[model samples]
Target: MMNSPVETIFYIIDETATILQEELSCTYLEAVAETGENLFQDDILQDEVSEVTKKRLQKSYEEANIGEQPNETIRKAFQFAILKGMKENVQPNHQMTPDSLGLFISFLVNKFITTEKQLTVLDPAIGTGNLLTTVLNQMANSNVHSIGVEIDEVLIKLAYVGANLQKHQLELFNQDSLEPLFIDPVDLVLSDLPIGYYPNDVRAQDYELQAKEGHSFAHHLFIEQSIKHTKGGGYLFFIVPNGLFESTQSQQLHEYLHKEVHIQGMLQLPTSLFKNEKAGKSILILQKKKEGIKPPKEILLATLPSLMKQSAVEDILAKIDGWIKQNK
Candidate 1:
């Protein structure tokens, strides 16, 4: 029932009965990275997702014009794969956790942007466009606009269709977020930044030895780099695991980030949030500001809920919304 990127972006998911994929792609450990496989082979996106699910999914992608995004490498392959899985009655969670999306939306709707009356957002790291899709659903055509950037060309194309389906005016770029990037000033910025894991190569030679300890130096560095363009006072959010978040051993890396940005809040997620083989996960929310007093150290943390559990997504969303409204 969704029509355009603006209309369909977040139209498909029902917070009550969201399913999850068992394993996220092991791109970091795999000898090779197959963006296509990860994009299409997701368990939840399979045939078991339901006709209503497929319809919502297709509507979201179509509205965004994500399929027609500026790259031929991406096609309807991801969509086809999801439906194919559904046809077989597969009900696994895939690359992302729809259950956690409500928490994120609560953050986006209230804390992240200056106002919900109007918004043009950006997600630099759009994997299969899940987070952005979730954000779109939360915004619900309330004059909230969006743009997403993804390194994987294939996913960008799939995201284009999903994003366009929501009636969002999206511009997908086939480029790494680390490189000099450009986009119009936006009110909100959300991303699952590229931690050193996941088949990253930017710091291979620079940090191969220290790879086991934490994210590469390049990733830590990129955090500061991306913040440069994020408008002052604009909200910024991303995930970093326990190894990185509470790393007394790796204090230098995150400490530098703490120094560079004014952290607004943080969500110390449980390890289960990352169904992938990765060590752990954490969610951070900060603001891009030119001048300001440091954010409180008592950074209120939202505990990471089970990403793959039989729970009500809206219940979680309501909890988050209550927090957001209170914060304002």
Candidate 2:
């Protein structure tokens, strides 16, 4: 049987990356980024690799014909390669958002912003760029400008090469997202918030959501940063901890949200998606406060059924659609 497009492309990515990994003495993810860049440029840019290895890589690239594949095919293929690399050397912060959740977020984004013909989207903690690209792929409008901020060098490189491979024209910044960003207000902000304490106390002090003492929660600072970069009344979608509002600093977060944004919805993700119940998270929809816009008459709250159950998921989505039609 012929290989599926995703399998074929993933095989090419894995094969080329393995060869590069052996040649460069680098980590699997680093080699994967190099492989993706080589594919995007249609040339073996690594001079360190032997002539034999270069020839092998070129053959794989030619056979794969990555440019002819659909954008989602390329994205998924690269995503598989990234997942493989993560398994080889796992970093807690290097995780990519699951495709199912990314797709659902895309649906919410489309429903909320149907009137906008052109939009700018920002992902403050872009990581592998999977979530942002997935959302972009599902959006109805093609005229979108995207910006991704990531602090890790290897992850950002992977994101960059992945964007090139998928032909997504996004601007990426390789720096701490908590620091000042030299970007204009964007139409939408999407992030899977990085959960941890931020080490930079001075920088944390700059954010309204910063903790009162000691190290601040990085996720809280990220929410404030994302909101700051979003235009008034623009939407911010976050994958947050289920207990996001139950922390010691919850009062401050509540105050900040009350002052700056209107809670649009909260959808508790299925516990089955995580390793355990404590690790489960939810999708939070917030719209930045503006002069005329008011809170939804009733927040769109739902506990999502397992994404594996298509009919149940669709039924819940239909209810969500009804809510959107009535409120949006």
Instruction: List lDDT for all candidates, in order.
Output: 0.52, 0.93
Query: Can you tell me which runs of candidate 1 are displaced by over 4 Å?
Result: 1-94, 97-99, 102-116, 197-215, 246-249, 276-278, 292-294, 307-328
What tens-digit string does per-residue lDDT give for candidate 2 at 1-328? Answer: 9999999999999999999999999999999999999999999999888998888999999999988999899999999999999999998998999999999999899888888888999999999999999998887455898999999999999989988888787999999999999999999999999998999999888888878888899999999999999999899999999999999998999999889999999999999889999999999999999999988999999999999999999999999999998887
- Give the lDDT of residue 2 in candidate 2: 94
Q: List the residue pairs that clash in candidate 2.
A: none
Tens digits of lDDT, candidate 1, 138-221: 565367767777776545655665555444567787886656667777767776666554345544334322344544454464
**Residue 199 displacement in candidate 2 (angstroms):** 1.5
Clashes of each: 50, 0
**Cα RMSDs of all predictions?**
11.0, 0.9
- Candidate 2 local lDDT, residue 305: 99
